[model samples]
Target: MSNTKNTAHGQVQETSSKSSSGTRKPIVLMSMGAQERAGHEYQVMTKKYMRPLVEHAGCVPVLAPTCFGSNDLALYLSMVDGVYLTGAGSNIDPSLYGQENLTPEKTQDQDRDRFDLPLIHAALAMGLPLFGICRGMQELNVALGGDMYQKLYAIPGMREHREDYSASVAQQYADVHTVKMVPDTWFASLMQQAEIPVNSLHGQGIKTLGKGLQALAHAEDGLIEAVHLPECEQFTLGVQWHPEWQAAQNPFSIRMFQAFGDACRQTVEKKSRN
Candidate 1:
């Protein structure tokens, strides 16, 4: 019933013989939990939609709450083979990218920024696979010295990316746009297609790509739909759509997770050998 074999500290304990005692699963730490509820005041925790998708990817998805301090953060980073910065209702504080929250209401996750920004940097520094979706993508760009348009809709020529509130969850997540792949990119290599349709749901988007990152795909209206860190030499990628939604049903979505799973597996093997 589980995809993980056995894991710990970013390593997968794979046994060569039948008598092996234990095997640690390769865990991919998801930095999320319960944010806020109608009657609740404080966001006791954080949560993500990427859990089941990561599990489908063939690794353990561990919830990493919004923790503080360098020491504690280091511990979280060390225990996982990869990081999946899940999308949230909040947006990265504009201040991080040298802008004020043009619309404070649209900017809700400063607390999250404190943990996620550093997490992205640390994961990349260690060369662990890092993937971002929606808000996660914006955080990655900001963390790597890129900027985002506070309100994507406000920007001329940009189409609406938010899901319609009235529709059911399935209808809301319907793929409404086509994202064409940029030639000669890692994402393209995985897809092996000129373009593919993807579901869109976000309030903000990248204005300038972060340092060492490159666009992998763009929407019909010319917005960057996906990006990757070619220089990192690890699996560092992001997409504006919600691939986690019914991921197992789509070839593109399944391929994305499989790639991440492969990266996690590779990390486990490297650690096991060392």
Candidate 2:
């Protein structure tokens, strides 16, 4: 069932739609990128990120186009129970955090960077359940006054975290390293373990922890793998890994999605009473 209505401008409007079970599924607002395919610009979001939100999280995913900008950010946030910031093929523009374009030749989604950064703040201000993956996590950090390493591998003592393009797709996404969860953190308790195997696939990594954000897990190389606002009672989290990839098959990914789903459900309940 579709949970959104389309406007002539290509923006989406949320609907009070219910599934066949006579219950409304929690709606998640996913930010989209403005990309050109075959000489035409398109609002695009990867399909992998939507699957776990539907299959495991029991929510209806809705797209928020980057072309529309921040004029309607509040209206969009008000219509959904959660916000999901997904990864992209292009990197965020470095100027957002007072840095020069160190990687000018690399592709950059400036439109998305402009929109999603403000969307992150509006979602947090509204106390919506927020989840970010890969580039999404970096966006969240920058929005909250943090910075990133443009090229993670070039840093002294930092290991190469980019995926092996030469390997098979499954092999490239397969677990390649381990991350140690901080004891007593949500992740450690959720997984019930100290260390968990994870896949690494990114050229950029967090260099400074965002304000009010705490590290939930870290790779053996000391790179922060997961972060959350410790003071935020709502579900506000960002992970450096791509848990949405084959998420249904991974136990850790399943738990993460379920937790996010539960948080979205709680938001629905709270909004219903208001």
Candidate 3:
């Protein structure tokens, strides 16, 4: 553990450990929300799948609320070394990307968009490490001036975006599927194995990429599965698969989080000097 502080910019500041023998644990913020449930219940929750992922990656997971006011948003962003945009149950409004609403199965979570979009901009501005999963990945694209397909099934001849497989078995996990990783990519090094079998569970896919973003990995069906910002020195990787769910049983997925944690630690160390 290391001492954590807040900078003038309202970003969380951390000091790396003096000991050089071990890797420092990164303090990560996982985004969450509160919504009106059936009846009189107001449900506020964070996904159970994200916990082991962070822990295994050698980082501390902090639940960040999506309803933060502008001031609180800065405070929240300032308190973590890195941010993980977890998957949500809703689709992002297309209006954010300067597009007409095309899908009927839209459940817009404006609060999340409000919280995450600004935080993302701040993080990128501050050079903080970021990782997006599924909806998180989609949101990252939108935040970066990209557009999404809304519904993959509606793409005429597109195959299923959501893969069907039992999550319990690692051998069966990459089951009969392959994703091509771009040569000489950071993601290729992090994932170690090229042509990885990834589990997908989203109706949406990136149609137009944001500026300065490069597709790191893609499905055999030509769907974008992973992306990275090559311009940013810090780690800003987004994957369509649920690495959190697979981290426990899959070494391939676990390394992704570990790599992110490593990046956050490095960022904290570099910032400590300035």
Candidate 4:
């Protein structure tokens, strides 16, 4: 709801004049939500975290609202070159995927899901570049016929979702976990490092991978931490960890954003020619 004209990471301001002809415009769509402190005060908070990632990668961060209905969803989806499915506090409704309710802690954000599910489908149908982080990753899997572990701890021996000693959302943490990237995968190439360290902060993980999704990375404990669609021409990735949170400080994180931004650019250019 609050529009701040600034680059990704809150550094640069975008200008039409700065956007040159033949230069592709990468439009990044972020999910919306209600403020944590003020219930019902809905706004797009992902932009605050994603702005740096998008702008640094030379892409325009577009704040897409979850208020769009079925009639307007298609129109909005068509405008973006790529979509960034950011993290959210609510869980996807079990009914959407034909599953029984798993936990009592599940918080439903039907309005947001209704708005994003169609958009995700439209992007995939069009082969637009898409990136999912944390909840975003889970949603992507669900959209593609995968399921999620409603509560990670409920599964015996699972690690904690909310790290007790980690820093706040705005700050970076020194505790890094290792993930093994699949050999010859786009993610392996993008990150350059096969075993990389990443921040941990999510309770949910992919239960059953969706069709066409390749497992690109896994945690030390063998948890599926990253996934991608190989059929897409551009980079379409989803990570269980939040890259935007530490991308500005970590080279690995920055590379992930850069790769996604490059894909977005390509998609924009291809669209413009047609």
Q: What is the C-alpha lDDT of each candidate?
A: 0.79, 0.89, 0.77, 0.75
Off by over 4 Å in 3: 1-24, 40-45, 163-176
Residue lDDT tens for model 2, 1-274: 5566568888686645564445677999998987888999899888899999988988899898888778999889888999999988889888888899888777898889989999988889899999999999999999998999999989988888999899998998999999999999777898888998999899999999878989999988999999999898899889999999999789999999999988988888788788
Among the numbered candidates, top TM-score falls to 2
Answer with 1 or 2, whichever has the higher lDDT. 2
Q: For residues 1-274, write the lDDT of model 1, one tens digit per residue.
A: 1233645666565533111123455678777634555877454423336554445566777776673433577888778888888887777778889997798756375667888888888898888998888888888999989999888889899999888989998998899989999988778889979999898878788899999889999999999999988778788889999888887688898899888877877787788889
> For every candidate structure, what is the RMSD over all alpha carbons to the true structure, in angstroms?
5.8, 5.5, 7.3, 5.0
**lDDT computed for candidate 1:** 0.79
Give candidate 3's error at residue 268 in angstroms: 2.7
Worst 10 residues of 1 by lDDT: 15-24
Instruction: Give the candidate order by descending lDDT.
Output: 2, 1, 3, 4
lDDT of 3 by residue, 1-274 (tens): 4565778877685645432445455678777765766655242555545666456666677777676544577777777788888886688888999888777566778788888888788888888899998888888999999999977988877777754555544443344556899878877887787788766667789999988889999988788889989898789999887777646777777788778877888876776766
lDDT of 2 at 162: 96
lDDT, residue 246, model 1: 83
